[model samples]
Target chain A: MGRAIRQAPGRAPRTTRSLAHARFLLALTLAVVGLVLIVMLAVTIGPANVSLAQVSGSILGHLGLGATGTDSGAVPLLIDSIVWELRLPRVLTAAIVGAGLAVSGAVMQSVTRNPLADPYLLGLSSGASLGAVCVVILGVGFALPAAAFLGALAALFATLSIARVGGTITPARAVLAGLAIAQLAGAGTSFIIFWSAKGDSYREILNWLLGSVAGATWNSVIISGTALALVGTGVVLAATRLDAFAFGDTAAASLGINVNATRWALLGSVALLTGAMVAVSGAIGFVGLILPHLVRGLSGPSHRRLLPLVAVCGALFLVVADTLARTIFDPRELPVGIITAFIGVPVFIVLIKRKKSSAWS
Target chain B: MVVAVPGSTAGVVIENLSFSIDEQVILAGVSASVAAGTVTGLLGPNGAGKSTLLRLVGGLATPASGSVTLGGDEIGAMPRREAARRIALLEQNTAPSVDLSVEDVVLLGRIPHRTRLLGTFGGDDDRAVAAESLAAVGAGELVDRMWHTLSGGQQQRVQIARALAQRPSLLLLDEPTNHLDVSAQLSLLSQVGGLGTTAIMALHDLNLAAAFCDHILLLQDGKLVAAGTPAEVLVPEIIGEVYGVECDIIEHPRDGHPVIVFSAPRTAVAPMRAAASA
Candidate 1:
């Protein structure tokens, strides 16, 4: 019906169009290739010190291609176990969790219309920690990931209820309410840690709190992989709607969006995605906060171009960071969160100084 | 000018439209009709509910106890996407929270027309339409510029280009010339006149309304005070009654349209002020 309006005469020359999108696509393609390379390389960098050949041989052999393994003389059992059992699942978990957190962060920033927003800023991580603490320190019977998801959902409900008091939820009110819930959840987690945690068990609890994928198994990979595949795709497909919210609520409504429904759906999707990532990786920080902004610098703020690249960049970033976390201290490993923060703060500072005036409205 | 969509262009009819917020009435049973393919100016002082009335007509809000119909279809009953395809509203002083390119902002107008199930980005035809819309508004060269870097007048033009890209049969504008210079304002209003679609804009400038709009609807205290041609409705008495200001109307030298020159407030309040002092 509206095709005539689209067929206006003398179509504008294609060469006159902006090359920013072309540049963005090139960058996205490079990022995907870089991620694949890094994933293979990250698998080989450890105390075991395996080569790329061994890593590939182990992987292909496990996927039912036994010919490659026979060429390497049946691929030693120890190397195969390391590549398939320990390193592969941990690296995959890092990549999946990274993608999930980064997507959640991008969606959160757009939905809240705030540049500083991240998945963890809304109490999801603290709530998940509280859930994990209940099971670990207090001897609760629930599965750790399930408990964490429920706790994250509960925190989201609380934050929304507080924001909704006396009126509809504005972005400012929702952010403020999230801060309140984060603080409340943080205090509860601390109290439980101090009152009940005993001796060396405190170290384990601290490791989970600080965030790590060191304990990731095939089960962890399955949990986070499924979440990212489902919720992550849904969010990315709906990312275009996030652009409608760029101007304001009324403007989006005038653009034919059901503003309230779109906002709730996105926020809910982000919560589910963020909760799954946290359940698997124990609230890995900085990947969610820094990756989207870093990618946005390359892709501008159009969510369609910005999000897919952000997901890939995030996967590359965490895979590299987790590799450093395990190998940096030799036998004593550090949580991946520490490396991310160390990297994130400097990059974040540079971003703030460079784009301070132009990044925000 | 863009080709008008067949069968979608229709006049707006607001009948007994009333709306309130927290028990405070914003629009009180105001009724008005805008003929198809004609430019109408909505004029009133602050709190006169001109913007609210535009919102109702655009189907962004539903009336409390009455109806707004576009062509023969009730605006409130149409799907949001269908309503957006038929009506576009250019709001005043709205900017995106994130930095966006001028072309990206213009492409936003294509969202309602997206027919694919999971269309995450605009296609070739959409981009062509967006570029054409920008060219129509004299902003084709600004397609790559960042929105935040534009001057107020330039930004206003980009916003108009975005609205044009929507290809709506009916256009609603709230102070579309709000922050522009005199020449910019004149050129923008002229562009609006050239667009060939039905349009209703709320304007504070009487002379601009007289020069561009084919019809005038004067509002006062949530009610429509007058609805007619500028010569019929831009008389000094109606203007003074609605705006509480004294004004004179003269014929424009070139076009013979009403030229309203606003003067001081009316003298009705002098005796009341003297009695309060006593």
Candidate 2:
């Protein structure tokens, strides 16, 4: 190593790095502000006619802040029930699930060194679906969230064991194993649906499979929020070590990282976060897969720069998508996954068409 | 500026090193010592464990048995980060999954220097070192470019800059000139030779090795066949026996460096056209 003492950056490259940093900060700030506005807008636009002031008042009243209303009185009980009881938890769940899935996707891609990887790449979604199907169709008595979370964990363990069959788990082997398990679980889910799904239960299973935040309560908010706060933060904090992986495992090892240990830790964290999101939202698509790629063009590929913005963009994206899901069809709600896929496929095509993007190169 | 000093406390010593995979022996009972602040060329044909030896020496892989000591301290005993702070390896094959900017790639070299748990982002000093390393490798102008946008030769230079940014005392490179044009190959070697750090590079070209290396270790089937100065090791007798080719040694016109000129294999078969048709 050169001098152990640090030196100030030279004039030229300092400006360049800081400029990128400033851009990242600006994007993050904009995304956060957008998320807050969208959440408020989403809270007000539900089937129940609620104004933005009423929504804010309800939230403030519940937060123990003095409820300042247009009529100089407390917000109406009906408005409070609609906003706080009905819409707020749903929006919050969507946002938390979005952020968690996006961060998980970013970490997954980096750890596996695959551009196409997502949080559910390890068969978490298929496993969760199989669990939820059993609960809804077969009338299994386990709580829906518990069953789904356990199913996801089981899938993770199975995939990892298969990958570890002959030797240490490699990214290629894990991915392949995950694919195999996904297929098996997917077939199992299909078989259950085909064999036993009744009339009303079909709609229920379909809704869960397609993912919805319509049933989100404060409990959903708490579950997804705590997971994001814990695992998402750790993944973001490991950004530099993630960057060490850009040149492959040997290069990362030479840079002093324990390649296998770091990979396992990161993969485990991503699985936990993804499992939490899946348990709540039932495999909401596109936010995890598309959000990181969408923001990578703006934030660049460094996880330190890309992850925060991806989380924010993801939250904003899902909140908007969920709002559109409920309101666009008005009274009849589409699953949020349908909206995400509808939006995600087009955006993904556009991103792919922009072949000059160095992020993909 | 401080003169380039040996980053480790002393030279590296290897004793009876052995490595294998899947019950297949790769290297067996190989031993050598490398003096500090010198460039040594590790010369061998394909499958001779040259890459494996570099990985072992750089502490990227553990030897099945035996020890490699750097500056008298065993490498395997050191924490990964401590070993990384003293050594850097440039592997022959590596490609980023994402399209990273050249600066982002080079800044990764500063990871080991960070002490804080949350020090994930690079500070000003890292950018400076990255820039300095780029300039050192003559890739300063390429910093803003994306890694995938660079030509093969440019990419090689940037990769070298990333390694230089680590400012390692012991630099190990596997075939540093693999896919470069002649000019690029020359420039890259010259740049590496001027770094003043102790370096061990695997090379295929005898002439380049002879010109740039201070010492040479020749291997055959993962065993050291010869170890000496380039003049001592690159003689026709040893080259013919190991490489199975007829070759003549001639001194360079300008520098008097030994250059090997190959004529043909000792027992040449029919040409490729007839052989392939058969």
Candidate 3:
């Protein structure tokens, strides 16, 4: 019986398991390298046409590694200002926001057990937007991110309360509750905008609404970057617990996870991450909604291999998308949201039409 | 059969357990004990609270008024993780929405055994255990197949593999054979019978229960109607009263287990008046 068990018919050979593990590792390493390359290449592609070498030299020089060329003294002040002061922060912010949103989306989908669930599925983006618009329009002295984070927490509480029926939350109820909250928050934002806007403030609010990294500063980079690193690390560490949920709530509970508590904590953390990204970049779309599915197509549904890769790919995607958004329109400068929608909608359709069997039913 | 050694912790003992949802009592004061290493069939009709009773014993739900003890330890007082290490429950019709390979699904059984959050949960040892479990369920060859692609019987087999991977001392299954064919159902119960673990299985098939279960606990309307060896519990009178149908009980020629055969309802109505007029 032992020998028969060992030689069971459909079990993949030991070699295959190792090979799959190796494949995941290879994919992860490639994504990391790709992210680094994209970030490097993106910083060099803005309107001023800063050469790759100068971009590299300026980055190295800032790190106290000394400039690459002998004529370091002759480096133009304008190029330095453009590279260090303008483009680098914006690109970095875009990358971080992308990563944050994608990770949030992946976590949300797993928690809700819904394929269509995105980071904003719980009305997070709308809540954050409401907070931001209140700040921008009402001239509130509070920082926009603080207000946005609070708004997101409020919306999460409201959604949870609405979804909860006799102490259990079904996926359908949660989705419907989130949709209702999203619409309510959206209407609130629109009302605030309509009631208050006067002069150039309208342009500022519009820029925020459309989701642009055009105004990204060092502070924006710091805020989004820190949020991604902190919250992203937590999400990756919790991957195993999340994997236990693959079978459903009762199965996860049987596996020793406190299913309800884990779901609530994870949902809260995702909201925090999404709120931070939304506060910084003004509700960029698609990166969160589509990137996880794309990554799952390459790596299987194990969150252990899925989470980190999703984060990196998300960063790579946003950096590339933002680059296109700014460069494609030249001086006019389109918002990154518009660019993501154009690319996202077609890819989503193709994914649907391909009808390949995915982990998501 | 492994008999319960009086004071051993290997058996499950339930005392005066009651549970209700929204004023609808699902199980009321139900009590029974399953011996160590015996396959005890939970026989009941639909809405008879068999599933609810199994959940309470598995600690998936808390009883309203009584207690379940496993080996003398209060199951409700045990830490969920500790309880999980010793007990595994397989619910009916479980199909994960997420796409996962058969191996991955089986590996989920190892979660309670995993000690650290940061380390790899499914290591070589875990994979070996999972493979052994799949092999035990005759599903070893399906380790690479996607879960959604599998037929219902295949999925049930894989789910059994997942439960086996837990290596639980007490296994609870709720209508595990619902999607399986006759042979598959018999084979699965036979496999469980050989595992040397105390198993409580909720089953609708009286014959299958008679053939495989060492003992039978018959339930009706949230209460225990009968509990004993198959011959003692599966009488025609109890079957008639509980199922509202007439039935005959006979000894199986091969195994001497009680075999139940149902007859048509005794109170058949006369020919309809409308049909007579037409």
Candidate 4:
């Protein structure tokens, strides 16, 4: 089901085929290894003099797999707290957020048949931010995260409804509607935050708006992990329909796809993943937009190859970016969104300059 | 469960087939029949229901209170994919999507042959069949070329190859030669005509239709005004009545086929001027 179409010109070299397949597998494997190493380094490299061994043992012990700690007091407790309650979930949360966002982006791009279309481009993030803003600034919901999740979900629904006005959703129409609603949501959020400014509480708005995994804990990890598993399976199940649709709606229909059902099912799945991602990570932008394109470039735009490859690369991409955010300033941590945008902007510029955007269609 | 459709059958019959978009009445209750394994040509002016009737028979649209049937079964009664498996439709001016190679587009014709639960292309369904389809229309090398990068004629041939790949019992084409040059157009229609599959093609040029088609269907303002061999349907009186033009049609010397020659419209009102002179 996951086979990449073997296509090459002239007398296709056997070595070239094996090499390309080998390269894809190697890249994914190395990325996983690199992510694991970075997660360990990230756990131990802060102000505390925690060694690699200490972090590993703490993790192993927490998992009921390592040697017990020698120190019986606050030292062992602090180690357990940092490794278990803090760094572990933060790293896991970044990976999960990356996977969910990337998968949804790939799905959305294929469904919309527009390369620039990302899951959050439909106002999922801004909606979530609006939800968080009303709670954080106006004291709307004392539980800010839950409020942000609901707000994000609402925004996704609103954008989808506006785009689907005539019982048909075109690529240009959907994007236009999404942009309009996103601006409105942004304005509403700014109005609430600006009018109700009290002291330096603007910093709270910054954290949520800019996106941070600073809030990640074991609980968020569990919930986000479950959501990704359920939704990822759904995406893979719809893989053939996506492949058929890559040809366009008419072709897909001739192939016997119920265009309406497939569209709604895909819309619901991507919206859920986008909402869940924003709810957990407060909208770490750019990875969703750029990662799928990069993967598609490497492996041609077949969804069978594109979806899983995009997921792994997305997970690896976010974990590395978040690690840099934590380690770049060392003592003072920057938000992961800042790092993602900083990386995303130049790559996006290069993508724009590349004259084959028409090729994406 | 590969359940068969209730009314799936083996031959097509079009009765009073007509279609109009935005009230323009492209096809006016045109009726025709294409027997199994025979290649037929649909010939008419630019806006004729040639394509419209083809679409009707292909089940792309339902007729305006008319019936299109396969064997004894109405086309509207069969399930869509099962119906698609029976008839392959190649519409004109279809653009190839980005990054999809020619092989990918050709392989799409095998979609109906797929088992939905396990949607994998099997070993028996690989390069051999694709190569055979490509070879049928002399596109054996283009099986690897990117679809978006092909020339207009090459792309048309590739699409024909795709329809051939479907191995559909009934192949329906709508002006499959719109932008093609002379040789490409001839070889395409000629090859398809000899492919041993039942083919119904809408063609603009009466000469090519006359040369290659077993039977010709002539349409005018959506009416099935004429249907016969191309030589019979392409007479001067019928062509003039349908197109409002004076023309001389002569049989070709080498191949001995009927050829149509269009004369320019008269700027002078000859009938009124003759009356004034008198």
lDDT of model 1, residue B125: 82
Chain B alone, candidate 1, TM-score of: 0.91
Sort the predicted structures by lDDT, highest score first.
3, 2, 1, 4
A1-361 in candidate 1: lDDT tens per residue? 2223433355444554446668888999999989888988999988897888888888878888764444656578888889999999999899988888888888877876655566665677767777877776788998776777777778877887887757666555666787788778767877888887577655565565568899899998998888888887787677678878788787788888888888888877777777677777876766777888878878877777888888888898899999999988988889998898798778656865665553332
**Chain A TM value for model 3:** 0.88
Q: Please name the candidate that would achieve the greatest lDDT relative to the true structure.
A: 3
Q: Give lDDT tens digits, candidate 3, residues B17-92.
A: 9999999999989989999889999998899999999989999888899999998999999988888888889998
lDDT of 2 by residue, A160-205 (tens): 7997756556655666787788778767777787787566655555
DockQ of each: 0.39, 0.40, 0.43, 0.22
The residue-by-residue lDDT of candidate 3 on A1-361, one tens digit each, is: 3424444454346777778878889999999999888888998897787887778778877777755334545347678778899999999999999999989889987877765566565677778878877886787887877777777778878887998898766656775787798788877887788787666655555555557888899999988888888888888888988888877888888888888889988988887887778788886766777899899976778887889889889999999999998888787778898888787777656754554333223
When 2 and 3 are scored with lDDT, the better candidate is 3
**DockQ category of candidate 2:** acceptable
What is the Cα-based lDDT of residue B17 in candidate 2?
93
Worst 10 residues of 1 chain B by lDDT: B1-10
Q: If both were scored by DockQ, which would come out higher, candidate 2 or candidate 4?
A: 2
| Candidate closer to the true structure by TM-score (higher is better), 1 or 3 | 3
Off by over 4 Å in 1: A1-13, A16-22, A67-72, A135-143, A157-177, A199-201, A347-361, B1-8, B96-98, B266-278
Docking class of 3: acceptable
Inter-residue clash pairs, candidate 1: none
Summarize candidate 4's per-residue lDDT along A1-361 as a digit string, tens digits: 0001222235552344356557777766776687678778777766566777777878877666765556442237677677777887988899889888889888887876766667556777778778777775677644655665677668767877887755666555666776787778777776777788677556555555567887898877876787788888888877767877666666565665666688778867776676667767776777878898888766565566677778878888888888888888877788898998898878756754663444232
